[model samples]
Target: MTAAIWTDGVPVQGLGLMRLTDDGWGDSDRDPATLVQVALDEGVTLLDTAEMYGNEDIVGRALGSHRDQITLCSKFGVYRGDSGRHDDWYVRADPATVRTAVDGSLGRLGVDHLDLYYLHHRSEETPIEETVEAMAELKQAGKIRALGLSNVTLEDIRRAHAVHPIAAVQEQWSLTQRGVEDYLPTLAELGIALVAHSPMGHGVLNQNADGELAHELSRIASELGVGAGQVALAWVHQCARQTQGTVIPLPGTSSVSHLRANVAASRIELGDVDIRRLTAAV
Candidate 1:
């Protein structure tokens, strides 16, 4: 039962809800309730979502009964009403807008308070201090348990944390995409956890099971009697351990089987030699 350390001292580790609903990327035939239930039963307690993903309502419906069992996390800042394209959403992190967004998210999710709320992206128009002050107000009012930032740089994190203590930061991190590694020292210094989205390399590592990096992962997985994806996730866990920061990889999947596999990856341990081989392969 390896766990990602949160600032609040609660255990959190598991899948994200990015693909739980149909968002024009692909059709999802999976029932939201079933998906959420299966994830919980498998010990994947951290469920991350965003208003921009167009699946907050579905997530709300699914977690209505099981809300107490999950560490629910959702993001604001992206205006989803203007266009259907995911990238077309506009940034709105002003104090007024942040208030409106959190209220809307609360209504959609049927939750009075969010376990963690995030500013989906940095808005150049709005200063981070103002936005975070507003978020700190929410915490004081008991609307959110913790503050989080997504798609933010180290500098942005410092600015925001100066206003309020940031509990977590979400970034796209994977074996092939290690840019987020640069911010680990800063994150550790601030005592903020790293929530890694796309921890599977966007399925590239799984797709290239016989390729170079994947080949090494497969070899290691075979020796450990685990799947290659599990090995990759273990590498991330190892990175977090080495950096003295918590790293929780949110690998989203609509399939129940895949969800179980991803959750089980949390328990895989990569030895020193396995880590060196995997690191060199990348």
Candidate 2:
């Protein structure tokens, strides 16, 4: 639907898109367009899409008139076929690949310049240094505004940041997944923002990590006066209050109402007890 999460570090806000694995929109009652509009009206400024999602067309269609008002992040690395082999993922980012990926993303997104581009690289085949250098050059050349990385280690981040100024780092950081915590302090020291994908724990955390985003929403519908996604988003906000608020959680849905509820979570304030329960439950 949209990533209503924003990092206080940069002025740009965010809207993280899902690969949309299924056909039905959330709640089985909404279409893509209505949900996109609601997010735009509510101050979500960054739209995240990936080459793997096969939803660039849908994302492009939903962007409509608000394209200029948002910051868009599209990722590329592992090349996929229609058959969905989806493997042999590139652990390294190459200049040629990054260039070609940006060109393709620009074509699919129908835009000239990308707001932020990440090296969807995730392996050891190619030297990450070579790839990050290319990313730096791309930013200097006006192909992208900012450079980011995903699924990387602390050492990888250190090496990459030494070569270029990274605007953000996208990772799987949620109440259930605290691995990033071990390294997030280093990121904070480096001034890099955390784009927490699956911040709702893929619909598991708010649903108590039950593996269904919809069911999770139902479980927390009454307590916080919002959906489960809202509760989870609120938890992230609290997590960052003690940190840098650099924790930008991405909770997406095809439902307009749920998307709004997700945004409303930005204003939610979970009590210290609730925060303790949510944090430890993970």
Candidate 3:
């Protein structure tokens, strides 16, 4: 079994979550509450969601009576309105909005305190310091255990960390999308963990995958008797290990089989040769 690391005292390794209710991508017929329980039974303790996902209520219902067994993480600073345009939904992360957002998230998730709360994105209108200070106030008030930032640059991270210690940063990362790698060293220096979302390349690496990188991953998976998605996740995990920083990949799945396969990837230890192959493939 892969060893679990402590993120603000919460034990977690490979993270998992059900798709947001409004995303129109998840299985609408399958119950998310049951899926969350299945994940808990399989040892995937870090559950990630967002207010923008518009499924916090469903997550709350699913988390009922089992909140203590997992680390609940959700993001703020984004929402969807009637307009449907992306620009109309990016809310400013000012102090007042931060307070109101946390309250709404808590109410929706049916929890008194969140294991980790993230500022969904950097707001152009509000200073990062002010937003972080508001988060620190929430931490002081016992409303949140730790703070995180998502989809941010190194400068945003530096500014937020200066105001308050950031426990983790969530970003899109996978074998095909390695844009976040530039900030790994900075995250390591700051002693903050990296929560990687879309570890499977939005299912592109698993479907009609024919490029050199995909071919290499498939060969490795065949050799290991595992799915290609598992190999891709293992690559991300191995990169984090080599960099001396904690990386928890939140692979969202509605299928039980897929969830189990993802959890199993944690035990897939990539050797130096395998790492070299993946590095070259990327």
Candidate 1 matches the true fold with a TM-score of: 0.88
Clash number for candidate 1: 0
Put down candidate 1 lDDT per residue, 121-145, tens digits, no spaces. 9998999999999998998988888
Cα distance off (Å), candidate 2, residue 74: 0.8
lDDT of 2 by residue, 1-282 (tens): 012223322432256776443354453346666566777788776678887666876777667777777677888786655565656333436788887878888887777778778877555876778888888788788878888888888888998889887777888767677898877788888878888777777776555545443444454557656777677777776786678536677776666666777778878887787777666554
- Point to the candidate with the largest TM-score: 3
Better of 1 and 3 by lDDT: 1
Lowest lDDT 10-residue stretch of candidate 2: 1-10
Full ranking by lDDT: 1, 3, 2
Pairs clashing within candidate 2: 1-253, 3-15, 3-16, 91-122, 91-123, 204-209, 207-216
Alpha-carbon deviation at 27 in model 2, angstroms: 12
Reference-based lDDT, residue 196, model 1: 87
The models' CA-based lDDT, in order, is 0.81, 0.71, 0.80
Better of 1 and 2 by lDDT: 1
Q: List runs of model 3 lying over 4 Å from the truth.
A: 1-29, 85-88
lDDT of 3 by residue, 94-202 (tens): 9999999999999988899997899998888898999999999999999998899998889999998998999999998888888998988898889888888888888
Which structure among the candidates has the greatest lDDT? 1
